[model samples]
Target: MAKQRIGIYPGTFDPITNGHLDIIKRGLRLVDKLVIGVATNPSKDPMFSLSERVAVVERETHDMAKVAGVEIDVMPFDELLMKFAERVGADIIIRGLRAVADFEYEFQMTGMNYQINPNIETVFLMADPRYQTIASRLVKEVARYDGNIEAFVPSMVASEVVKRVNESKV
Candidate 1:
């Protein structure tokens, strides 16, 4: 039997913007199974905790898994990304590119990841034009100032972001 093509989509997913979801949905099309690795990067000062981030990804991607007929798993990892991919048995690492600036950063990371594990390939998916400008950081910035974020994130995530922002102000 052929081996399953497993791919890892690792991110901080602070509040999982629409662009992230878009990447997950599209990434599923390229692999038989996908592992969404939520990173606990304290350096980024994420809006959500690792557990909260995992729950948010699970809740948001539940339907996509069923519709795509692809097995999806959400996991939290704080170790090196290549190590996480190796642990997940990932044959590919799925990345989303929004613009040239993103590519410049991703290109360097991809090269390093490749050097770490040549067997694992990195695939880049361009963000749909509509969501190209939507980023988790900018989404939080907008929500922090009471700007509308429904267009950038799911309703649940939008509410969560607002709640967190409001709580932080207290």
Candidate 2:
């Protein structure tokens, strides 16, 4: 039997976007199971709750996971990513590099992750050109201004972003 290839792609995923789904699909090709970790960062208050983020991620990836024959689980975690990766028995850490700045940060983190667990390898996937400019922060900013985010996020998430924006206005 072959060894299981488990990959951990940890992010805030405030509201999982189509760009994220793209990375998940691509990551699935490299691993049998991909766990999308929604960061439960205590310091930063997100527009969407942790559960909401996880729910959207799960919903968006449900069909893709089934069709691609890759197991996908969306879970919330508050811990060092390396520790979370180790706890989940992940053999690979996946990061999506959209630009040079992202690479600089991820590159530093990848080195630290490797030091913590030499057995675990980090894989960087360049974002699809279409999504190269989509960032969650910018998405939220646009949604706050009632700008159309249909091109950046899934319909469900776009709705959630709108809902949250409206709630915040109240």
Clashes of each: 0, 0
- Per-residue accuracy of model 2 over 35-98 as CA lDDT, tens digit each: 9999998566688888888888888889999999999988899999989998999999898999
Write down the TM-score of every candidate. Answer: 0.98, 0.97
Worst 10 residues of 2 by lDDT: 41-50
Candidate 1 residue runs with Cα over 4 Å from true position:
none
**Candidate closest to the true structure, highest TM-score:** 1
TM-score of 2: 0.97
